[model samples]
Target: MNPLIKKLADLSEKKSRLIIGLMSGTSLDGLDIALCKISGSGQSTTVQLIEFVTAPYSEEIRKQLKRISSVENVKLKEVTYWHAKLAHLHSEMILAALRNWKITPEKVDCIASHGQTIYHYPARDQQELMDPVNSTLQIGDGDHMAVKTGILTISDFRQKHVAHGGEGAPMAGLVDQILFVHETETRILLNIGGIGNFTYLPAKNQPKEKTFTTDTGPGNTLIDSLMMHYYNKPYDEDGNVAFSGDLNEGLLRELLNDDWFEEEKSKTTGPEFFNIPWLKEKMEKAGINQDELDPKDIIRTASELSARTIVKSIQQQKITSETAVIYVSGGGAHNPYLMQRIRELMPANEVKNISEIGLSPDAKEAVLFAVLANEMLAGKGFGMEIEDESKFVNFGKISFPD
Candidate 1:
C-alpha cells in the first residue's frame, strides 16, 4: 500500500484529537478559523468547537481577491502570488489566534484549510473547452501553513470527493452528520454563506438511510455585490439595504428562471455562475436600465431568491423518516432581512442559529474541516470515496514541513 494509505490505516483506530479547521468561502469576507476537540469517529463522532474566529481581510487584500475571485480570464500571475500570500496571511492569523488563546500549535493534532475558492465548475454541462467531469482548485499553499504553524495541515478537501464521482462541494454533509445527528429528531444545518447550502440530518430513527445535503442557491453573494456596487461597502449591514427596499417582481421572476434551480439536490454553484454580470444580462434582456435599478432592490431580490430556492428544495425532499429541525449559520444569519425571509418561508421549522446548538454558526464550517484533518491523519477511512464513506472519509492534503 502507499505510505499515505498506510498512515491513514493506522489513524482510523484513534479515539480523540484536538484539531484546527480553516475555511474561506466565496464571499471574500475572510477566513474562518476553528479549533475543535474531536472525539470518536463515524456515527459516534463528536466535534466540540473550542475556539473560533474569522480573521477578516484587509481592504486591499479584499479588493485584490475580488478582482480574480470569480471572473473569467483573470491575470494568472496575480492569482498565483495571492495564493501564497493567503497561506502566509492565514498562517499568521492561526498563530495569533493560538497565542491569544494561550495554546501552542503542538497541542493541536492537525489543521484543515478549505483554502480560497476562485471558481467552482461543478461537473455540470460538458463543453469542448473543458472536461466537466473532474477538476476543482482551492489555492492557499498548505505547506506554508504547516511549516509556519509547526503542525500538520490539510487543505483542499474537495478534490477527493470529486475524484470519487461527486461534486466538489457540499463537503459539509459529513460534518453536519457528525455534529447534528439525533436519535429521534431530524435536523437541517442550513449554512447561508455566499451560497445557501443545507445538510439534512435524518434522526437516528433511520441510520441505514442515506443522508442528504445540497447547495440551495444564492445566499450573501448577490446581496454583498449590490452593496459594493452602489454603497461602495463590503456588505449590507444587518441587511439594511434590503430592509429599505421593495422587491421588483419582474426581476425576481427573471432571477428564478435560471437553470441552476432546476436541478437534482446534488447540484452546486458559486459567484462565477451567479454574479452581477449574469444578473445584468438578464435585466438587459428585459430592457431594464442597470443604473436605474436600486442596489437595494438587487439586495432584496437576492435575499428573496435565497428564500424561494430553499423553500423549493424543502418541498422536493423525499424525507419521511426524520423530524426536520432547521439550524442556520454564516454571515447571512446576521442579516435580519434574510433571516426574516427564511422564517417566512419555513414557518414551521425553528430556523435558529447554530449557536443555539452549542456551535458558532459562523465558525462551524472551519471546525468541520479541522475534524476532517484529524480523520485524514488518523485514517478514519482509507482509500475510500464518499460513496464508500462506510466511515466519514478523512479530508485535507498533507503539507510537509521543511
Candidate 2:
C-alpha cells in the first residue's frame, strides 16, 4: 500500500506514456538517445520506438573520456564534475532531439537515463573493505539531468539489483522478459555490445516454463579497444580489421583459458574484466612470435570470441526449439564480420537486427532504460530477479521536473 506503488499502478493503467531512454555503451562512441512510447508491462508490454539515433561524440571528448575509463587514479573532483556535465550534455541532446522530431517534453512522462559508468567496482574488491554492496559509480547525475531537461528522470538502476543480491547489471534481462516472452516459443535475445550477454526464455507453454540469463564472455570490448589503440579509430568498422587478419589459433587457445570462462558468472560484466591489459596478458602468454600478427588479428579474435561464446551459451541451454530467434542490438550488430561469425556458429538460430522487429538495434538499450524508468515511476517490479539470491526489486530513482 505504498504511495509510490499506487502511483505506479495509476501510470500503468494510463492510456499512454512517453519516455526518453539514454544509453552510451562501453564503445564510448556517443550517446544513443531514444524517445519511445510504451504501455502495459511484463509480457503484456508493447514498445513503440518513436525516434532514435546515435549521437556522434567529438574526438576531443572521446580522448579525454578514454583516458579516464580504465585508469587507476582520477581526481575525485573531475569524476564528480563530469557526472553532472554528462547529464547536462545528454539533456541538451534530448532537447535537440525533441525539437528535431517536433516533440515536446510536456508530452513525456519520464526519462530513463543509464548514466555514464566511469567505474563499476562490484562488491568484493580486495583493497577496499567497503561493506559488501557498498558502492558502484555511474556519473550522469540524474538530478542535474532532471533540472536541466525539466523532465522527471529515473536513474541509478544497478544499485537496486546489487541491494537485492544481484551483480547489478545485465539489467536488460528484466526488460527482455517483459517484452519478448512468448507462450509457445523458446526465445534467446542476444546483445553483443562491448560484451556479449543473453536471456533464455524457455518455451512458455512447458510445465516448468523457465528463464535464465548470463554473460558468456568478451563481446566487442577487446577488439574495439585494440582498434582504438592501434588504428586511432573508435571501433573496427564492419569487422574489416578482423577479416584482414589471420586467427592466431595458439593465441585464441591461450585467451580462452582465462579464469572467467571456467567459472560461473552471472549475466553481468563490463570493461572492468576485459580490457587492453587483459588482452595483452593473453597475447604475451601465447607469445606472438611473428610480425604477421598485426594488432588487427587481436581485434578479429575478440570478435570471434564473442560470437563463439554466445553460441556456446545457447548450446548449454539444451534447447530443441527451432532456431531461437537471436535478436542483435548494440554496436556489435552493425559489425558484419562479427555477425557472420555468429550466424556460422548459430546457424539454426535466426539472427536479425532489433530493427527487423520494429526496434532500431542501436536504440534498443536506450529504450530499455526508458521502460525501466517508467516502471520505477509507476512503482512495479518486473517480477523477482532470476534467482533466490536477488531481491524482487523495482529499480530507478526519480528526479522530478523542476
Candidate 3:
C-alpha cells in the first residue's frame, strides 16, 4: 500500500484525532483557525476546541478578494493567482497560529479548509445561465495547503453536496445533527454570518424528514457593506450605529417585497443576491432618496430586515407546541439589537449564544468543518433525506502531503 494510504488508515483507527479547521466566510474579514480534538463519529461524535484564532486578512488581500467576490466579471488572472497564493497565505496563518499555541504541525492529523467563497449561484438564482445547475466556488487549493503545511488536507467540501443534488450550502445541518440533536428538545442552530442560515434539528423522536437547513436571506452582509460605505468600519460594533437610528418601515417593506422570501424552505443564498446594489435598487423602488435619508436610518432598517427575515424563516419551520431552543452564533450574535429583535419576535423560544451549549459562537463554524473532516475519515455518512434525495455522501476531497 502507498505510505500515505497506510498513514490514513492508521489515523482512522485512532481513539481520537487532532484536526485544524479553517473557515473564511463571505464577509472577507479574516480566516478562522480552529484546532479541535475530535473523537468518535456520526451521532456519537465529540469535539473539544483546543485552540482557535481569527487571522485578519491584510488590507491588500481583502481588496483583492473583494474585487473578484460575487462580481459578474473579473480578471481571470486574479482568480488563478489568488487560488494558490491564498492557500500559501492560509498555510502561513496556520503555522503562525500553531507557533503561538506552541504546537508542531506534525501533532495535527489534518486541515479541513472551507476555502473562501467567491461565487455561490444556486440553481434557482442562476436562471439566466445556459446551464443552470446548483453551483458554488471556493478557492484556495488544498494541494497547495498540503504541500505548504505538510499535513493531510481536506478541502472544497461544497462540491460533493452539489454533486449529490444539494444547493451546496447550509452544510451545517450534517454537523448540527451529529452535535446538537436532543432526545426530547427540538433545537434550532442559527448561524448569522455573511448569510443567515439555520439547521432545524427536530427531537430524536420526531420524524427525521421534518428536519432541514436553509438560508434566512441576508445576515451581516448588507450591514457590513453599509458600515464600510458610511463609517469606514468593517462592521457595526455592538449594533451601536443601528440603535442610534430609527427603522424605516417603508424601506423595510420594500426590502422584504421580493418573491424570493415567499419561496419554499431549504434554499441557499449569498452576498451575490443580497448586496449593496440590491439594497439601492430596493430603496429606489421605494422612492427613498439615499441622499435624503440618514445613513443610520438606512442601516437600522437593514438590520431590522435581517432580524425580520431570520425570525420569519424560523417561524416558517412551523415549530410550535414545544418551545425550541435557538442557539445563535456568528458575527450577528454580537449585535445586541439584532438579538433583541429575534427574541422579541419569538418570545416563546429561548434565545441564547451558542456558548451556553459549550462552543464559542465565533469558533462554531470553524469547529464544524473540523467535525466534517473527522466524519470523512472515520465515520458513516449522514444526511437530511427529505431535503435532498441523493444518498448520504462523504464530503471533502483529500490531499496528501508528499
Which candidate gets the maximum lDDT versus the true structure? Answer: 3
lDDT of 2: 0.76
Report the lDDT tens digits of candidate 3 across residue range 1-109.
Answer: 9898899899889889999999999989999999999999887899999999999998889999999999989999999998999999999999999999999999999
Write candidate 2's Cα lDDT for 30-112 as tens digits. Answer: 89988888877655578888888778778887776776675679987878778877888889988998989998887878888
Measured by TM-score, the strongest candidate is 3
**Preferred candidate (lDDT higher): 1 or 2:** 1
Error of 3 at 155 (Å): 0.2
lDDT of each: 0.78, 0.76, 0.91
RMSD versus native structure for model 2: 2.8
Please provide, for model 1 over 38-149, each residue's C-alpha lDDT reduced to its tens digit, 9 standing for 90 to 100.
8876556677788888888988888898887877689999889988988999999999999999998878777788989887876674465545575567888898888888
lDDT of 3: 0.91
C-alpha TM-score for every candidate:
0.91, 0.91, 0.98
User: After superposition, which runs of candidate 1 have C-alpha atoms over 4 Å from their true positions?
Assistant: 1-14, 128-130, 207-209, 318-322, 382-393
Which portions of model 3 show Cα errors greater than 4 Å? 207-209
